[model samples]
Target: MIGIIDYGMGNLFSVSKALERIGVPYIISDSPEELNKTKGVILPGVGAFKDAMARLQEKELDQFIHQYVDSGRPLLGICLGMQLLFEESEENGRFQGLGLLKGRIVRIPDRDQNGERLKVPHMGWNKLHFHQEAPVLHDIQDGYVYFVHSYYADGIDEQALLASAEYGVQVPAVVGQGNVSGMQFHPEKSSATGMQLLTNFAKAMERSEELL
Candidate 1:
């Protein structure tokens, strides 16, 4: 039984529907009790970083999420959920994150070395170039995943990065460090490729322990 954290901020219907499409049994709930017992937990969100953290805290599920990930069980964060896994974000101002991964979120440079308006929120589909062969992206080749975000995680070492995507610049699309995994793109909205990636994630979640 996989649990999707229902913090009232995620793309709930799309994510839930996608999981169902893969024939994976899942429950969406905000209760900590249910979260503690689930085989795997998915933190999905589509909103501001500071607001999401506040709601998670208000619901008292932040600590439980941390404990679940720390327990070595597979925990995946999607979109804004991915940002929460980092140390902090500068969306509105400097705000602390869940610190599941050692990094901070920053937007892409408006201009390159040559100088040009590259745009802020990167909204479109892009391919993921795997940093190294791993199970999270197993059975999945480099393909496009839907992304729509202004802030990108930065200062992360090469070791923790799983995949990169092109958007005028290379953005870390998929990231993993041990049992914790995250995707800047919304797999639920990436069509066939996205569906396959989610299926892979479900299988990874079922594993007793990650193979690395």
Candidate 2:
């Protein structure tokens, strides 16, 4: 089973529904103890970085995540949840993140290098370009995925970058380091490409279980 952290800010319904559609059993809760029992965890969010971090801290799940990752359990973050995995975010002033990965979150450029006005909240489908292989990306090819965000991950280490999408900037689309991973796009809403990602993640978790 997978534990979906419900810290009062995530798109819990959509994420849970996606998991169910993929036939991946999951439990939604705020308790780390309950989450720790699962083989994998998913952190899904859709809101401000500061607010989300405050909620996670209030539940003490922030520390729980660290402990869980230290045990080598897979943890995937979606959208805003992805940003929280980094060191900090400039979404609304400088706020500390979970620091599970090397990077910071910054707003998408509103203007291009040529001084052309670009759209913010890069909302729509974008093609993914794979940089490295990851278990969750197995059997997945370069395809379009749904993206809707105003900020993107920056200053990321090359080793942790799995995939990226082009907006005004080269947005970090899919990133992972060992058991920790994140997706800037909403796989639950990305059609075939999205479903494949969810399916791949479930399969990866199952494979890990079988090894034990």
Candidate 3:
């Protein structure tokens, strides 16, 4: 079973529905004890970085998450949740992140390579370019994924980057290191490719369990 951490943020309904469609059992919980009973955990969020971090800290979920990851259990962060996996973010002033991965989050530049003004939030479908092999990316070749975010991760360790999208910049889309992983795009909203990715993650969790 998967545990969806709920600290009063995230598109929980959509994420839970996706898991249901995939036939993966999951529970939404704010209690760390309940989350500890799950095989894998997913952190999903859709809100401001500072506020989200504040809530996580308020609930003491931050410590639980760090400890969970340290135990070598699989943890996936989606969208804003993904950004929280980084070391820090510059959105609405400098704020520390979960620090699961070595990187910083910054707002997507408003200018293109030629200094042309571009849209702030890079919304819509974008093609993914794979950087390395990962279980979450199994059977997922090149394809477009839905993205709706104004800020993007930067200065990330290239080794942890699994996929990226170009929107006048190399936006970190899929990133993973060991049992911890993150997706900037909402896989639950990315159609077939998204479903496949989620399915892959579920399978990966099963494989991990089998090994144990």
Candidate 4:
């Protein structure tokens, strides 16, 4: 089973529905004890970085997540949740993140190379370019995924970057380091490609269990 950490910021309904459609069992909980029962955990969010981090810290979910990851269990952070995995963010003044991955989140530049003003919140479908191999990316070569964020992860360790998408600028679309993974796009809403990615994650969880 997978635990969906609900700290009152994520798109819980959509994420849980997506997991259900994929036939993966999941439990949504704010209690760390309940989350500890699952083999894998997913941190999903759709809100401001500062607010989300504050909520996580308020509930002590941040510390629980660290302990969870340290156990070598797989943890996937989606969208805003992905940003929280970094060191800090500049969304609304500098704020500390979960520090799961070495990097910082910065706002996407407003202008392109041609000095043309680009829209913020880079909403819509974008093609993904693989940077390296990962179990969560199994059977997914390269394809488009839905993205809807204004900030992007930067100064990331090259070894931890798994995939990216271009939108006048390179966006870190998929990222993972060992048992921790993150998706900037909404895989739960990316159609077949999204479903496939979620399926791959479920399969990875299964594999991890088999080994244990």
Full-model lDDT for every candidate:
0.87, 0.92, 0.94, 0.93
TM-score of each: 0.95, 0.97, 0.98, 0.98
Which digits, one per residue and each the tens of the lDDT, describe model 1 over residues 15-55? Answer: 99999998998999999998777888899999899999999
lDDT of 4 by residue, 1-212 (tens): 99999999999999999999989999999999999999999999999999999999999999999999988888999999999999999998999999999999999999989999899989999999999988888888558899999999999999999999987788999999988999999999998889899999988988887776
Residue-level lDDT of model 3, residues 1-212, one tens digit each, is: 99999999999999999999999999999999999999899999999999999999999999999999877789999999999999999998999999999999999999989999989799999999999989899898657899999999999998999999998899999999989999999999999999999999999888877776
**Candidate 1 to native Cα RMSD, angstroms:** 1.8
Clashes of 2: 0
In order, how many clashes per candidate? 0, 0, 0, 0
- Of 2 and 3, the candidate ahead on TM-score is 3
Residue 202, candidate 3: how far off, in angstroms?
0.8
Tens-place lDDT per residue, model 2, 68-135, is 98887788999999999999999879999999999999999999778989888899999999999888
| Deviation in Å, model 1, residue 150 alpha carbon | 0.6
Output the lDDT of residue 69, model 4: 94
Pairwise TM-score winner, candidates 2 and 4: 4
lDDT of 1 at 126: 76
